[model samples]
Target: MRHIPNALCILRMLLVVPIAWLLTAGEYKATLWVFAFAGFTDGLDGFLAKRCGWMSELGKILDPLADKILLVSVFITLAVIGVVPVWLAATAVLRDVTITIGAITYNALYGYPHGNPTVISKINTLCQIVYLLLAVAAKAGEWAPDTALLILGAMVFVTTVVSGIDYVVTYTRKAIAASRAKHGLA
Candidate 1:
């Protein structure tokens, strides 16, 4: 029972692969439903785990992995189909790669815990998702979807840079402070 949320997190990660395949196949209707289901299950597991005090470091780690995989895969699919700007996809992917590498490096070197997203990061994620959905919707020749995707893409770009920098800066400062405090230097 304690592992239930972790299991769901893994399931969500797996869901990304097939959902990307469906989206790439131009199955918007089906992809939409699958994406919705994935989101719902993710929410359900998180909610239940938090309420039951079953949340763990493991779940914290895996949940974000699932989210990144889904978002990156969506960007790739939409870009391949010419629904999204390739530069935007590149930025999204590069940011994820940068952060993941930084997290791994920080965890190994400074022994810092995995930090959850700040509110800015959360808003950035929503913008990214909206950008993806609008791009997917634009494939059917809707101008509104196209316009919204462009606007959201720009916002995603800005937010990505800001959030990524905020994390790195905060983590670096915290590490320094922790080291200083540990040595009676703070």
Candidate 2:
């Protein structure tokens, strides 16, 4: 029972490869369906974890890790196939990379920098997922307009940059405070 959330997370991660393949192969409708299913699993897992008390340390790590894998993979694939702007994909990828490196450095120096996603971070994730969905849907069946995509792309770009900076600033402040506490400097 408690393992269900973690299993869903693994499922989402596994779906990433198929999603990328579908996108690359010009199977946008199929890709949209698979991608939407994958997104649904993300919400389901989170709900089960919170509502059923199925949360665990592994889930804590696995949930967001799965999201990162899916988003980064999709962004890169979209860029490769010319469905999305390359700079947007690059910005999204670089932000993740920067955060990963920051997390590693903070863990090495100040123990695991413990925290939850900020509100901005959550909005950023939502924006990215929505943007990708629209991009795929537009290709799949002309379901979205170009102007809508342009707006979403700009939202994605803003949220990505803002959340990346937010994480770095928030974590850096935490690390600094920890150092001060360790040194008894108030």
* Candidate maximizing TM-score: 2
Question: Which portions of model 2 miss their true places by more than 4 Å?
Answer: none
Clashes of each: 0, 0
Residue-level lDDT of model 1, residues 67-150, one tens digit each, is 788888888877787777788888888888888888887777667555878888888877887666566556544454445666
How do all models score by TM-score?
0.86, 0.97
Which whole-number lDDT from 0 to 100 does residue 59 have in model 2?
91
Residue 44's lDDT within candidate 1 is 74
Tens digits of lDDT, candidate 2, 29-57:
99999999999998899999999999998
TM-score of candidate 2 relative to the true fold: 0.97
lDDT of each: 0.79, 0.93
Report how far off residue 11 is in candidate 1 (Å).
1.5
